[model samples]
Target: MKRKYTAAAAVTVVATLSLAACSGGSSDQPSATADNKPVTLTMSTWNLANSPEFKTLADGFHAAHPNVTIELKDYDAAQYATLLTADLAAGTAPDILTMKNVTDMVTFASGGQLQDVSDVKLQSGIKGAASYKLDGKQYAIPYRIDGNVIYYNKDLFKAAGVPDPDGSWTWDDYTAAAEKLKTGLKTAGSAALPAYLHGWNALVQNFATAQVPASALKGDFGYMKPYYEQALKMQDGGLQLPFATVTANKTTYQAEFGKQQAAMEIMGTWYVATLLQQQAQGAADKFAWGMAPVPQRTSKTAGTSNTPITYGDPTGFAINVKTDQAKTAAAKQFLAYAESQEAALTLAKIGITPALTDDAVVKVYFGQSGIPSDDLTKFAWAKQKIDPQNPPSPKTATLNTVLSAMHSAIMTGSESIDKAISDAEAQYKNQVG
Candidate 1:
């Protein structure tokens, strides 16, 4: 997701660029400065107090390389880009910069603030690594990826006598299942919602792009119509919560699915961590649950025999251009370690989906306590194709802004799908063209 930069932050960046013209580019520091001596490197991260991924990676890397200390500099997740932009302008940004999405990487790269990390040999399993490349030069490498999947309450399905979802389900199959679940659940005297659709625009826009092609995001968004129609149909049928009600109540998907109020939810793999933590803390009820491949756009793409398409953004790390040669070397080492097999295991054990995953990583992930180990769950984890939610483009930010507004209008019944999409296209041409 993109965050708006404050005027002050923009001003700071412009001022820095002007000053940098007088001061010249970063000084060339030779690798001769690097040695086996102890060194401290700071890396930017978000929500360190609550999210432990950064610290876990840092500690694990430090444990293996005793001479290096990786210090984490935390910032508010919602305001991360704005704050990081300010820091970059002041020349006080962390030695290692954590890019939240492709847009942020583009911004940093275009500003000439990020070091070219093309030399870092990332694992082949990291599918989203190419998303960080611009002009044939790599800037960042992903450590973890959060792909979308259909998370279902197995116990709830059994209670309602509804069949559990498999890799073969298409959007039509999904709708039929939801309709059946709604009827069966009511007859069984259960109050659970058949499905829960989160309020985020990604819920609709990202799915549309993945099922079709991301290039649609750069053109007219006509590809999103059918998806919107299905979502609205479900909402109106009471198979899922209404967009307006969810927005007004500020409902969370965690509570909806965790409390058994929702039988199925389409969410990112990152929720695996939250659910496990909540169950352990007694915040969520313990029950049998598992993930399935998200419904496919067509029957041809809908099965274990075929690779189901889904959308997600990768979180990666980049190095600041101004860091000393010694720290730069150390920072690169940390990046390599972060995507290593050992690090993948550490992330998997904590319910986070590592980018560098293979059969071994899959074994570690399912072997973790409280994680479902059923065949369907394993299938969901092992196979699928992920498309970047945000494709690289200078005008991507404007396109997303237009799509988000279009999503809200259609989902809330404020405007017809055709009308909303039409308006968005006009806005896109006006601002992005």
Candidate 2:
């Protein structure tokens, strides 16, 4: 999800820097003043892969600050962490870096690699900023929030004589709908992305459950057991599809949903835009779709789990401790600009719900595009359900690896649910410890 800055944007930034350097007479002095030198900053980010939206934002930055130069670098998601670590270790990290979550920010802040933005106005521009803060120090700014919602094909529902999914849909209603849709699907039944084991999907289901407030898990070490049980039930139900009939070949959930192979899929806001694009291309003419809050265990309290809550992993901008003071100031200015309304709007156009709270900007970008304007706002509400105490972390990788193995055993009828839970608990405790 890396994007590249355009050539024109690069040239504009360099020219701005050159003029600032010439006027200032030296790079040693602070670059911020009513008059004098310009500042040069470097920003590293993921999701810049030749995207026009990024270019527009970069160009806007140059226009706003005639003396500042901002250089943008894109990194592949798989290589970003490794490259960032190398940069930090070599004392050559970029002035600003993007962190994946509060967990990552905490780890880096603890390691003394990030600059504290506690005093910056940047906090006001970011949405869900509180979630990224640990103990009182703000280490990152969230640019967008994403959460899982049930995306169903309207055409398929109608054809299968299933009721439309709405805010009141219950888990039983959902399963029944799936059973109805299953009768007509090319495959034997519905499919859940295998990637679900990695906290995102499981956490979503956990929040939507009737059992307990997801927030109870925050800081409570033992709450994950119920979370695991809920996930196990969903998996057990989904596995009834024949191995050959269920589709899991695609690497991404969006891809599988886009092909209309799955009657319903659970995904974040990004998929809504992807579906819009497919519709525009006539690839989805036969399908009609809408987003509904994820189903709950009962219809009476369907909205009780925390309406409008979303699960978002924000990537933050941090400064390398070893970077020079001048570079640090420049980087801060660049970070500020990136979080501005103009930049956030550009991101929203491409389906990323901006971390900023400028509703007008959000409406402007999403209004003409025919996207559900309320969906983003609703997701903001949904984010409340995210168990801040048990928010997904790197440990989730190991937890999922074990869950996958246990799930395989369950699918083969080699283990009972109780045994699977016990085994998973043992494995997680061993790995986490």
Candidate 3:
């Protein structure tokens, strides 16, 4: 089903721009610097411009094309998304921009804001390309692929006499472990907490098989029911963070876990870097921790047509369709190199897992990187799998707001499940109409 989300995207453009027109030249065409004059191309991202990894990549781009200058439009991560949308609405979107995930890419693609790169080179063994495609057109240059994980305190599990998790672990196993941790564990602050929710949106994405419901505004949201029910079961049992408590604290789950207040959390692969840093520093609050595959559906929830699955996606750069031909060509070339195995190796050497699937390249990065405290990244290698993601309805940002509010209301005892779901669907219809 296709939806046109008008409110969240820039509605109409007085000027239509393409990164570079197809007629500009061959695919490998460089930006014109015919008079030996410098041509500068802008790349926008939430990453620190001077960070070692970015510096390495940028330096290599400049070194190879001495006539070209790379200007970084780095912004604070917290404000970058809002600023990016504002720039697009203002007709000042950069030549190349970093997108957070498939949702953000889909929003832009719906508005004809991203360049179609289906013609670009696709390297063998590179991964996660499908997550960034919309309507059969490639809208983003895929980079790193990340999957859901259960990051837990191993020492706490041992203290509670609960076994460490494995791939075979199911929802029943998770619930049992959480119950054990809740009853047996006490934090340094003398309060008892069983687990934390690292990300709410992740709860929406990490589960679901190929199924479509007749009336989910976007059929893609069909998976919301079982996952939400499972999470609520934990909340009702006092095994999950209270919505009121979490909102009052206003801190990341990482902060709560660092204080030894939580025994476990379900989060994505991005948290691995933080875990690596803590183990490397020998932080006192950091205890032995391990990673497990994100929980799978129990037999009770897995219908004959449904198979348990985890979600993985690419977060990377895309060319602005509005940029000039020369800059567009340059942007395409730069992304081409960045997605190569060579660039993947460079990204991985610094502990950033690349989207490349070469076993040799993956081994090089995971061999010593402290991603998992036990230095066992093999679990991650086996657990991670990427698939084509859903193209969110144009009203995604609005739908997310509605879903989140409804969930919070139900969790806090402010609304009944029947009332909340009905209200959410009604709002979805009215707002997305």
lDDT per residue, candidate 3, 1-433, as tens digits?
1111122232211111123333322325443344535667777755452234555555555555555566666655556667788898888877877776567788888888889988777778776787677777888877676666677787787777667765556676788888877777753233646777643543543354322222244623445667666677887788877767777777576666766677887766656665666656765265777766656665432322333355666767788889887677677877776677766776777766677757666666666555453433355453354444443446556766877777777666798766776787788778877
Across residues 39-108, which tens digit of lDDT does each residue of candidate 2 receive?
6666665545433444455555555555766676655545666666777788866676766445556666
Instruction: Estimate candidate 3's alpha-carbon lDDT, on a 0 to 1 scale.
Output: 0.63
**C-alpha lDDT of all candidate models, in order:** 0.82, 0.54, 0.63
At residue 33, what lDDT does model 2 achieve? 37
Q: Which regions of candidate 2 fall more than 4 Å away from where they truly are? A: 1-36, 50-56, 101-103, 122-126, 183-211, 214-251, 278-286, 297-306, 340-342, 368-415, 427-433
lDDT of 1 by residue, 1-433 (tens): 3221222211111000111121221122222125668887888877665666787787766665556667677777768888899999999988999998789998999889999999988777777887798889999989988888999999889988998997899888998999999999998999998999989998888888888764755667889898998898899999999999899999988899999999999988888888998999999999999999998889888888888899888888999999998888888887887788778888887777888778999999998889999878887876778888887767778887888899899998889999999999999898866
TM-scores, each model vs. reference: 0.91, 0.73, 0.79
State model 2's lDDT: 0.54
Residue 23 in candidate 1, Cα distance off native in Å: 45
Clashes per prediction?
0, 22, 1
Residue 76 deviation, candidate 1, in Å? 2.2
**Model 3 pairs whose backbones collide:** 20-325
Error of 2 at 102 (Å): 4.9
Q: Which candidate is the best by TM-score?
A: 1
